[model samples]
Target chain A: MGPPWWQAKFRGCGYRITIAREVILNTLAKTEDHLSAEDIYNHIHTKHPNIGLTTIYRTLDVLTNLGLVYRFDFGDKRARYELAEGPKGAHHHHHLVCTGCNRVVDYTDFIDAEVRLLQEIEQVLSKKYGFKITNHLIQFYGLCSRCQADG
Target chain B: MGPPWWQAKFRGCGYRITIAREVILNTLAKTEDHLSAEDIYNHIHTKHPNIGLTTIYRTLDVLTNLGLVYRFDFGDKRARYELAEGPKGAHHHHHLVCTGCNRVVDYTDFIDAEVRLLQEIEQVLSKKYGFKITNHLIQFYGLCSRCQADG
Candidate 1:
């Protein structure tokens, strides 16, 4: 892992690998939960008090634009983010968001049927609508086990 | 029909079916494409100039909260609104948004495999994570035929 793919991606896009950007990327890469900018700022504040919330927001915007991070809206008005390619490997996945608890589960256990269906749908839509299909975002919203149990 | 499902829903929730709300709902109900608050206001403004932008925004908020409308962010900063149950029958669908031209296509042609996979996944996720799944949002982002041809 020569400086990680994201660093290379930053360089490829002519973006500087500033400390703020690097820290933000590392934080998202290491954490499993979806985090808001304010949450991220809190996570980095004690260790990097100089890293302003504004910088985190701007860096997130840049990273999201570069496809290095994914911004999610779970109908909570606030945006949450997670790394596109995380420590969990290169396996692409969707999300199961707990609307009750704000917990997010990455659903990576893609069955053959699911994969085939997606590929087929892409082909069908592309042919039907003449779209050069690129990618997709899918999220299921509900109550997590703990939240249900609590209720 | 005595009243539309959404109108009943609003009444059930004790929200008055005011003209502003009714006009906003009618506008979204008739239009096929997604509209921002401004777009919706502009559309209604010509005929109903008395309906202010603030009222449009408020009604949209109310309608969205009532699950009568869906709010979408297509990677653009602007939010788009569409009826949850549109004039195209009760068929549930996803969206295919053009990254270039901001065109949105509703995909309702679900194959058996697609439907089965979703059902199976919901079951699996519910069992595996103890998530009582309620709903889902899925959108595919891509370039339309014209955009491809233009390039």
Candidate 2:
């Protein structure tokens, strides 16, 4: 319908849009779940044979640094990435990951209270430990019904 | 003084206590915060040179599997480990990490309402997605006062 969600984000963040960047962004845009860098790289490589794994890594890093994407780990060896530009635009959210099938479902309903608590904890830790807190991630791991059924 | 907290846990769980396991457990026990595998390896190596990195990996896996330790990612490249045998034990507590120095502070106090809400979210996700929810991890990140002062 309209320009894809990530395109608008790249524009808003003043990120230069290139074919490779577009491909990567589009890949993440279509995914409702988290994708490993390798997953994104393999998918893009099929359509754009010239795209290097390094390019995928670089693009992902740039997007993460720009706060247009979120990075996560679910006890898997590799890290995963997801578009941070939500349906509402520039929103923050957490995830519930089904350990059975590795599906990630986003939840933004509790963000305000979550953020407030996070800030309070950060304050307490800073005062108590002399440690600097930068960013954080919260993930819930469990089984989806399909997996639960099998189990 | 007395046996470190984890020593009791190993005995309580009926896990075989090995030399390397004790070193790993005690290393984590002596710390007041989280430590990466390499951190534990380095500290243990000074006293136990024959302790292979592979053993550290193996020991960590065993500890995690037995619920003797907890594993988490603090946006760090390496996985961090902490003793799970705390005042709140494994499942009931969350984490506070200082982004400044990579210190992890345990927070056992939790609002019951928040816990209930999380369980509700878990149930909803389980039903809607066919996923089974096992456990969750929540960490708050910010600058500790020492880092704030240094900055």
Candidate 3:
């Protein structure tokens, strides 16, 4: 309906949409799964072998700074990213990361009770600690089904 | 109470208790705040100048493996550690990290609703994804009072 997200996000900014950056953004947009820089690089490399890994990493940082992407650590050593311009509710979903097999499941099924609980928690934290809450991250660590079966 | 946590943690295991390991554990036990590897090294370096940074790193790996310590990343690009032997509820508490000044508030005022939410999420995830749930981490990122004031 309106302007596409990438344009809207950087219209005011001087960030020129390079081919590499465009490929990275498009790759993330199409994926429903969280991906590390290496993962993105590998995917982009298949289509655009000329795109360097460093370019992907740099573009990812720019996207994260521009708020077009979300970067998080799932207790995994590497940082993972997802497109923040996706569907509204999709951006706030939490993660279920399997510690054994390193499987990540994006869980967005926030019940009414959970929403109320988060609101209460944010209220309490903001009042008690004088923090102006902006964002939150939650991840559950465990074993995936295949790993559980193996274990 | 029962042979001390460090001793019990390595009781049956072939891990011998070294002076360096004890210092590492004792240092973690003393601090309620998360300490990075460099932070821990600095604290112990003053008292035990002989203890090398490599020793601290190795000891941290051992402690983390034994579940005697907790390791997490606060999007700060450094791994942070905290003692796992804190109060029952203390271990399960979440973190409120200030993006402005990087202050971390360890919030433990969890009610039954939060626990229930987690259980529900875990059950649903485990059922749908065949995950064997074990643990979880939650953190809220925002501006602290000082940062809010500065802004």
Candidate 4:
């Protein structure tokens, strides 16, 4: 299909659509699941060898700033990027990441409950500590079926 | 007066009691707050200027491996670390993090409900997709009072 909702969000965020951005966006869109910046760089490098690691980092930064992409740290040294603009927004989904094989699956069904709870937490924190909460991420780590079976 | 549950957990998990680990653990223990590695490193480094950034990273990795510390990625470059063990256990509490100032508050009232729901999710993921989830992290992010006031 076309670019995912997150790609469109980048545009909505007033980001200038450039070759590097498009390449990075397309790479993320096509991935079956989350990919690290290094993964993206290596994939794009084979075809567009001119692409620099700095450019990938910069584009990912822009996408994250625009709330168009989500960055996950599944204990990996490098952050992984995934399109945040699915049918639900970035905050709507949680991740189930396989530590054995490094696979990621998005769980979006609990958006309403999660959002409500988060709002309540925000209220409590603000009232008690006068701190403003913005966004958060939840991730579960475990083994995928194949890995579990292998183990 | 003593280490938080998580710090005790690290000791129980066979983690070495090194100066770096102790400094890091002490920092987290003293706070009812969540802090990024950089925050912990900076705070500790002030007292021990020779500690390297890599040591912070390594100490965090060890703590996480032992399930003594929890890592949070609130759309920030550096991940935040907090003591995970509570009166109940490491998995009993969820975190409320302030997006404005990066302050964290721990909440433990929802354990029963979360445990039930998480069991169901685990079953679904395991049955349908063959994913075995061992642990999960839930954090809610929002604007704290200071951010709200400044805004």
TM-score on B-chain, cand. 3: 0.88
* Ranking of all predicted structures according to lDDT, beginning with the best and ending with the worst: 1, 3, 2, 4
Error of 4 at A118 (Å): 5.1
Off by over 4 Å in 3: A1-3, A85-92, B86-92
CA shift at A149, candidate 3, in angstroms?
3.8
Per-residue lDDT of B30-145 in model 2, one digit per residue for the tens? 78667888889899998899898898999999898777788878666678887875754444567766666665666665545447667776776666655567777777777666
- Candidate 4, residues A76-134, lDDT tens digits: the string is 66788887665643445777888887777777655566566656655665566555555
lDDT for each candidate structure? 0.84, 0.75, 0.81, 0.73
Which residue pairs in candidate 1 have backbone atoms (N, alpha carbon, C) closer than 3 angstroms, thus clashing?
Answer: none
Q: Supply DockQ values for each candidate.
A: 0.73, 0.58, 0.77, 0.55
Error of 3 at B141 (Å): 0.2
Question: For chain B alone, what TM-score does every candidate structure achieve against the true structure?
Answer: 0.86, 0.71, 0.88, 0.71
Give a tens-digit lDDT track for model 4, residues B1-151: 5654455655666765778878887788777656887888788887999888899999888877777677766555667777766565344577676666665666665556666666766767666666877887777677766667777
Native-to-model Cα distance after best TM-score fit, residue B87 in candidate 1, in Å: 7.9
Q: For candidate 2 chain A, which ten residues in a row score worst on lDDT?
A: A124-133
Summarize candidate 1's per-residue lDDT along B1-151 as a digit string, tens digits.
5676567777788899888888998899888778999999999998999999999889888988888888888867788998886445446778899988888898886645666778778988989988999877778889999999999
- Which CAPRI quality tier does the interface of model 1 achieve? medium
TM-score of each: 0.84, 0.75, 0.88, 0.70
Local accuracy of candidate 3 as per-residue lDDT tens digits, A6-59? 676676788786788888988988888789999998888878999998898899
